[model samples]
Target: MSIARNVPFETTLQVRDTCLCLHTQRAARALARRFDEALRPVGLTSGQFSLLNALNRPEPPSIGAVAQLLAMDRTTLTAALKPLEREGLVAVAADPGDRRSRLLRLTGRGQEVLASAVPIWRDLHAAIEAGLPASGPDNLRGALAALSQPALR
Candidate 1:
């Protein structure tokens, strides 16, 4: 008998058996979609927002370092940056310390766009926090940190 023929509809659709890495992934995805929609006015995908935010921290970070911080491969990260570069939100420049290295920097326009998106981000964050409690966002952040500590080592 075909497995599909015998299984109940609910059984067929259940994600519970797949060993989901993060139960919050669904929530995260939903949150990202909402953020993406809200950020549409600023012309940023959630992924781009994350990249911009990371690049905001320091200057002259090599492409490899940026990739490492984002937990992505150099090629994929480079691919993602293409649109950002094309839009003039970010720039890649030669690293003075290493001729072969390239540094990723956020542009002034990127900061402006990021600033515009901050209130929307804050709204989304507050919505998430409202669902929890006094310590919601902090506790969730802590949990993510604990979960990520091993991979970071």
Candidate 2:
């Protein structure tokens, strides 16, 4: 039998330094942790804050639409909604235009919670931006938005 060749350690180091997915995931997790701590007093996680913020529009969006915006699958979104629903922070109802399609909305309690969380988010976000290079925050956001495009998937 032919012997298998071993990959060089340098190649592993190169991937560790250069892989976009790895870097982004690490940053995402760190950011999530920071926000989670900041939001603890309000009893919300970063993901929950984001989900609630997305529903802060005048018109409620369909589940599919919210899933697309959040870059999550229907099942995952549905699972995430359970706790919020149980807390009476959100309501999922049949869309008036499409009976089979469900719409998601923030309840008054959700609005109250979100309002309470806003200043905390704002301060944390400002601190994060301040810690970045002068142009880093905008550049990083643009790069992330580009990567998050549906076409990229």
Q: Which model scores highest in TM-score? A: 2
Q: What are the TM-scores, per candidate, against the unseen true structure?
A: 0.80, 0.94
Model 1 poorest ten-residue lDDT run: 15-24
- Candidate 1 lDDT over 91-149, as tens digits, reads 99888888898999889998898888788788877886888888877988898767655
Q: Give the best candidate by lDDT.
A: 2
Q: What is the C-alpha RMSD of each candidate to the true structure, in Å?
A: 3.8, 1.9
Q: How accurate is candidate 2 locally (lDDT)?
A: 0.97
TM-score of 1: 0.80
Predicted structure 1: lDDT? 0.82
Candidate 2 least-lDDT 10 residues: 144-153
What is candidate 2's TM-score against the reference? 0.94
